[model samples]
Target chain A: MASGNKTTLLFYPSTTNVSAKIHPVVLFNICDSFVRRPDQAERVIGTLLGSVSADGIVEIKNSYAVPHNESADQVALDIDYHHTMYLSHQKVNPKEVIVGWYSTGSGVSGGSQLIHEFYSREVSNPVHLTVDTGFTNGEASLKCYVSFNLSLGDRQLAAQFQEIPLDLRMIEAERVGFDILKTTVVDKLPNDLEGMEATMKRLLALIDDVYNYVDGVVEGRLIPDNNIGRFISNTLSSLPKISPATFDKVFNDRIQDNYALVYLSSLARTQLSIAEKLNTAAQVL
Target chain B: MANTMARSFLQAVATEEVAPPLRVVQMEGLAVLKIIKHCKEFSPALVTGQLLGLDVGSVLEITNCFPFPTREEDDENEADGANYQLEMMRCLREVNVDNNTVGWYQSTLLGSYQTVELIETFMNYQENIRRCVCIIYDPSRSNQGVLALKALKLTESFMDLYRHNSFIGEKLREKKLSWVDIFEEIPIKVSNSALISAFMTELEPDSPVVQCDLDRLKLSTAPFMERNLEFLIECMDDLSSEQNKFQYYYRNLSRQQAQQQTWLQKRRTENIARKAAGEEPLPEEDPSNPIFKPIPEPSRLDSYLITNQVANYCNQINGAAGQSFSKLYLMKALQDN
Candidate 1:
C-alpha cells in the first residue's frame, strides 16, 4: 500500500508468439496468504481474470518475484507452492487459474469503459484494479493498484500501473464529470450503465463550458454577446444529434446501435468549443 | 228606489186577480218615472204603496229591513208558494225593465237557511231561463259575503248528503243507517252522472270495461312475479343448469319464430307466383329443420388445466427466491456437463 513500493504491473505485447496473442498479461506474486480466506483466494486467483482458450491452456512465459528478503533465493518456488496448494484445494489446474485471471481482467476492462464514460465529467482520474498477480502475505506481493498522472511542479508524469489500465484510469477521471450531469438528467432518459455514462459525459462537458463562459463574463474578460453566441451556437449544433429526429429514435429502437457513440462525440465537440472560449476568456481576464 | 219599485210591482201582481198573465213593460219608460218620483225620500212611500192599492210612481224607496225567509219556512207556506213565485217573477221583471236601473236587498238574517230559500225560489221561477243569473256583488262588504257564502255551501252540501242518504235507503234496505252514513260521508261526489256509470262498469264482471281493467292490473303485476320468481329460480339452479335452460328456451323460441316467418314468406311467394301464372296456389307445410342444441358443459379436465396453469405460475414466482448466482451458474455448468 506504500506509494514508493507500488510498482506499475505492465502487460504489453511481448516478443514471443504465444505472449503476443495475449492482449493482457497478469502477474501475481504469490506467497504465504494471510488476509484472504481460502474461498476468496480461489475466486480471485483460480478463475481466469482475462482471456483463456476453451481447451483451458494458459501460457505464462516469464514471472519475476521481487522478494523483500534478499536471502530468499527460492521466492518464486515458495510462491508457486502456495499457489498450487490454493488451486489444488479448489480442484482447478494452474493453467485454468491463469486463464480465469486473464478472462476476468478482460471483463473488468470492458466494464471500466462504461464506468469511464459515466464518471468522465467530474473525475480527475478513473483507476481500475487489474490483478497483476495472486495475493501473497509478504509486503512485496503483487496486489491491486490504481494509475494516476503525477504532476511534479512543471512536469507531468504519465505513468501506467500493472494493476490499473490507462484506459480505466482515464475513465475514472471522466467519471467525476459524469457524476455532475447524472444529478441533472436522472429521469429524462434510459440510464443503462453505459447509456447513462455517455449522457453524463455530454452534459457535464456542456455545463463546464457554460460555467467557464459565465465566469469570463462576470470577470469582464469577454464581451457578453460573444460569450452568449459561442454558448448558443455550440448548444444548437449539439442539439440535433441528441434530438428525436436523429440519434434518439435509432437509440430507442436498438440501444446497442452506434448512434449513441456518434451523438456523444458531437456533444463533446460542441462542449469543447464552448469550454475553450470560456478558458480563453478566463485566462485573459 | 229600484227595490221599492220591485216591491210595489210584486204587490200589484199579487192583487191583480189575473191568472198569471204574460206581461211586458218597457224598462226605459219605467226608469224615467222612477227618477222623477224618488227625487225625495221614498221609504214610507214604498211601504204605503204596497199596503194600499196605489199605482205608485215607478220609483219607490225601501229600507234594508225586509225579512229573509228560510227554505223550510217557504215549504210550510206551500199553499202560498205559487203566489210567492208570481211575486218574485214580477219583481225580477221590474228590475229587468232597465239595464241601468240598480236594485238592492239586504238583511242581517242572510244565514244559510235563508240563502237556500232564495236559491230554491230563484231556481223555481227562472230554471228555464239561462240568462237568469244571481250575483252577490258586494265588493265593500266582502268578509260578510264570504262567510255567508261558505255557510251556504255547507248547508247545500248537507242537503246533498240527506238526498244521497234517502237514495241509499231504498237500495240498501236493512243495512240502513250505516250504509247511508257511509255514502253521505264520501268526500267526492258524482258531479257528472256519465262518469259515475263508466267507473261502475269496470266493477261489473260481464262488462268489457272489467276485462280492460283486469288486463291493466295483470300487466302491472306480472313483471313483479316474473322478476322475483326468476331470481329465486336462478339462485337455486346451478350455473350449468341455468345456462343450459336459458340457451334451450332461447333456441326454441328463435326456432319457432323462424319457422313461422319462413312459412309466411313461402306462402306469400306461392301466392304471388299463382297470381302471375293465373292459377291457385298449393297449401304449404311448415319447414322442418333440426333445432339448435345448447353447447355442452365444460369438462372437469379443462378446469383442472386452468387451475394448474395458475398454480404453476405461482410456483415459478415462489421458486425464484432460492436460486443465487452460484447456484444458477452451478446449474448452468451442470447442464453443460
Candidate 2:
C-alpha cells in the first residue's frame, strides 16, 4: 500500500493516513485551564506540545491556555511565552514536541481557519484539536483535525479542515483517576468511610492475586517464573513489621495530633479577631 | 501558596458592585458530563434539565443539574413539568447541593436547535430568571467527533419584544435587533476543583493501557458531510421562502404607506377647493389610516430564526466540506509520495 504509484487523487481514500495519540494529562490540563477561566465568553486558545510519528500518530502530551482576550501584540507575546514554556517542559520530558493546537467547543467557527493557518506555520501538518468543554453529555469529547490548503486554478486557495481520530493513552494511575472522575460524573462521591473501605477492598484483591499465584506454584500445578518469584520477594520484604499494639498507639497519637492542630487553628483565629477589635478600639480612643 | 492566591482572588472578586459586562457561567466537570450523559441517554427524544447553581451577580456557577422526566405532550403537561422540576430541586436541596435554577439545557440534533419551542422555553426562563441561559447539547454532532455544547441566551431586545408580544417589523426595527442578535452564544468554561486536579495528577503513574490505536483516528467523512449537505439544501429552501414571506410583508407595507400619502394629499386639495367654493369639504373618510394603524407590523422573529438556522447549516457544510477536502488532499499526497 505504501509503494502504490497512483498519481490520480480521485481513487485514494483518506482513511489510511493520519491518527493521533493524546495523553490523558493533556486533557486534564485543558479542563483545568478552562475551569480557571470562569468568565464564560472568553475565548481560550492553547498550543499542544507533542510529536507526530512517522506512521502519523500525533501524540499530544501537554497543553496550556493563552489566557483571556489579548491584543494583537499580546497574542504574539503569548505565543512567545508558550514557546518558552514548551521549551522548558521539553527539557524535562523530551518525548513530546509541538504537534498541534487546541481550543474549546465542537466545530470550526469563523476564525478557526485563520488560527489553523497560524499553527500551520509552526508545524507541518498541524493538528487542530477541539475539546468539548461544554459537557453537553457526561464526558468531555475531543476532536482532531488536520488542515491543508488546496490550490484551485489561478492561485485561489481553498483550505480544508478534516476531522481525525484521537486516541487517549493513559497510564494505569490515570486509568484509576479516570474511573474516579467518571464516578464523579454521576455527581455521587462515596463518603470518607466508604472510600477507605473501597481502598482496603482493592488492596485485598491485589493480595488475593498474589496469594493465588503462590498457591498454584506450591501445589505444583504451575511453574513459577523469575518475574513472579522476584515480585513476591519484593512485596514480602517491603511489608512493614509493626506489632498490633504499637500500630494502634501510633495511629491514635496521629489522630490526637490532628485534633490538636485543629484546636490550635481555631484558637489562633479567635485571637486574631480579638487583636483586630483591640486595634480598632485603640484607634477610636 | 497557590491555595491562598486562589482564595484571595476569590475574595477580591466577591463583590460584584455593578452588573458585569458579561455574565460568567462556571460549570463543574461533573455537571457538564451529566448533561452530556442525559442528552445521549435520551437520544432523538428531546431532553431538558434544570441547572442548579449559585448565581452571584454576574457569575452563574452551575454546580449541578437534573434532567426533567420524559413527558408526552409537554405543552399540555405544564403542571407535570413544574412538578418534576420542583421534585428534582427538592431532592437536590435535600442533598445539600446548589438547588437554584440558574438555567436549563436541551439536547439538540446537528445544530438544528433554532425553533419556536426553544424560543418559548427561553422566554419562560428569561421571564423568571433574568440571567437564565439555555445550554444546547447536540449529541449527534458531538458523536461525529466534537462536543456540541453551547450556552445561549435570548438577547435583551428579543426578550423584551417577546414579552410585549410584538412580532412587528417596526417594533423589532425600533429595538435595533436582528436575527443574529436574538440569541447570544456565551462562552462556556468546564472547571474541575482542586481535589479533582490533584486526583488527576495522582492518576498519572502506572497507567495500564498503552496501544497505538488507529480505529479512532480514521477519518470517516461521507455520511457526516452528506448529512450536512442535505440539511444545508433544506435550510436554503426554507431560507428563500422565509425571505419571500418577509419581502411580501415589506411590499405590502410600502404600498399601504404610499396609498395613505396619496389619499391625504388628495383630501387636502379637495378641502382647499371646497373652502374656495364656500362648501363644506367631504367628511374625512381616510380608509387607510384607522385600518392599518392597529395592524401590527409582521414580526421577523420567525424569519430571523430561519435565517440563523440557515447560517448554522451553512457553517456545518463549510466545515464538513473542508474536512472532506483535506482528507482527499492527504490521500492524494500519500499516493503521490
Candidate 3:
C-alpha cells in the first residue's frame, strides 16, 4: 500500500509523550498504493519516516511504497532508492527520520523478516508497521512491531516481534475533519438540523447527568465537591440573562425562518423546472 | 534515476483508473480496523457481517459495514429476520452510505476459511449480486504480528461447479479448476481523502533526538511456526485421506470393469454358439448387471482446498523459519565481529 507522501504530520506540543502517534496521511498513502497496483497483490512494502518528539513519542509523518522487486539485488537497489528519496524529503523538512517500514496486509509473513532485516540496516530499532488494509467492516487496523534480538544457545537471533500500542493521534483540526468525514459516510451533513438535533440530544443527556448529581447531593446521597460547586456557580453566572418569553419568541422565529428558507428554495427549484419545460415546448412548436 | 522511477510510479498511479476491468475491492482504513475490533469482540465464535458499499462497475468501494445479529430459528421468524435486516439497510440508506450488501465478512481461525457454509453463503450472494466478495479476518495470525485481512471471491469456474453441485473429477477436469483458483483474492486498498493527508502533514514537527531502540529487532516465530505446523499436519492428514478415498474408488472401478469384460466375453461366445446351432441368439447379450453399477466419485474440491491450505501453511512456516535463520545469522555474525 502506498502511504500518501503528501500528508505531513504536525507534532503537538505535549509535556509527556511516550507513545508513537501516526498521522492519517501515511495511512492514506498505504491505502492508495495498495489498491492502485497493476496486479492486485496483497503484499505491499513501504518505508515509514517520521520525527520523534523529545519525550520519545514517534510521530509518523510520511511513507512511500518500495516498488515491487523479485530479485534480491533489485530489492536492495529499491531500498537504496527509498533511502535517497527519504533524504531528499528530509532536506525540505529536516525533522523526519527513518522511523520504520510498513507493509499492507496483516501479520508479518516469511518475507517480512527479510524486509525487516533490510530496514534494520537503514535504521536502528526499525518499527515494522503492519497496516491491515483489507476491509471487512470498517477501519484499517494498524500494528507496530518492535523486534527483540534474543540469544539461543551460542547464536543470537531476533526471537520476537513485540507489538507496540499505536496511537493514531490527530490535531484539533484533524479531529474535526475526521468527525466530518465519519458523518459524511452516513450522509449526515454537519451544521444541518439533524446535526443540531443530535448535538442538542447529547447536551440534554449531559444536563440530565448534572441534574442527577445535584439531586444526589441535595438528598445527601452524595457529597458535592467545592470545585464542582464553584464550577457550576461560575457557569450559571456566565449565562446570558434572557427572559423566558423572549427566549421562546427568539427560538420560534429562528425555526420559522428556517422553514421559510426551505419553502423558498423548493419554490425556486419548481420554477426553474417549469421554465425549462416551457422552453422545451416552445422549441418543439 | 530514483527520481525518474518515483515520477514514473506517480504517473502510473495518476493514470490508473479508480476502477479496473475486473472489480477492485477498496476499503477505508477505519472499516478494516472496525472489522478487527468486531472479530476481537467475538473471539472463539464465528462472527459475520454485511458489507455496505457502492459498486461502481470495476471498483467496489466498501465504505461501511455492520455485524449481523444472531437470530433465533423458527419457520415464521425467518421472514421477520429478513425484514429486520431490510430495515437496518433502509436506515443505512437514510445515512447516504451504500446500504447494498455488496458482500459479507467472516472471522476465521488459523486461516481455516474454506468450509461448506462459506461456499454456500458465497453462492447465495453470487446468485443475487455478481460482484460480491467475502472478506476473511484472522485475529490469531494478526496477534502474532501480521494482520490477516483478505478479500476473497469465488472464481467463476468454482461458482459454476458449486451451482451445479458437481465437484466430480470429470467436471473438475473439464472446467480446468483447482483449489488455488477457487478463491480469487482481490487486492484491497485502504483509502483516505486529501483532507486526511493534509491533516497528517500538519502534525509533523522537528525533533532533535532520533530514537534508535535495540528492543525493536527482537522476534519470536516459534509459537507461530508451531501453529502453522499443526495446521499443516491436519491438512496433510485430510489430503491423504481424500487421496486414499479416490484410490479406493479407482480400485473398485477397475475391478468392476474386469468383471464386466469377462461377463461380456462369455455372453458373446454363448451367442456365437447359439447362432451356429441356428437358434435365435439369446436376446442380444444384455450387458446390464448389478455388479456393473457405477461407483460415485467423491468431489475433489475439498482435497484441492486442503492442498492449497497445506501450501499456505507451508509458506508461512517457511517464512518463519527463514526469519529465524536470518536472525540467527545476524546474531552469529555480530558475535564473530
lDDT by residue (B120-175, candidate 1, tens digit) is 53344233431121212111111111111110111223334434443222232332
Candidate 2 lDDT, tens digit per residue, A158-178? 566767777654532131234
- DockQ, prediction 1: 0.00
Native-referenced DockQ of model 2? 0.01
Ranking by TM-score: 3, 2, 1
- Candidate 3, A115-221: lDDT as tens digits: 77777888776788887766333444678876655555567654456566788654311322333333223222132223323433544566577789889999999
Single out the weakest 10-residue window by summed lDDT for candidate 1 chain A.
A28-37
lDDT (Cα, 0-100) at A93 in candidate 2: 43
Instruction: Determine which window of 10 residues in candidate 3 chain B has minimal summed lDDT.
Output: B208-217
**Candidate 2 residue lDDT tens string, B1-337:** 9999999888777745445645656677656665765677568887787787877766667877766766677675878566556655553353246667888898987788999889897777767875787888887754433446788888777778888888765565566666668888876655566545444544333523212111112356556656755775676577567667756766777777776778778888999999999998886675446634633455556666766776676566555544444434443333333
Off by over 4 Å in 2: A1-285, B1-17, B74-76, B198-216, B254-277, B283-295, B332-337
Tell me the lDDT of candidate 1: 0.29
lDDT of 2: 0.62
lDDT of 3 by residue, B1-337 (tens): 9999999999888776543555567776545654765576567677887897778868788876766654456877778657656755654443244567889998987778877778889888988986788999886654433446788888877888888889876676667665567888877766545533343343332321111111112345556656766776687688778778877887888888788789888878999999999988775345476776878977776776776676566555544454444444443433333
Better of 1 and 3 by TM-score: 3
Weakest ten-residue segment in model 2 chain B by summed lDDT: B208-217
lDDT over C-alpha atoms for residue A65 of model 1: 19
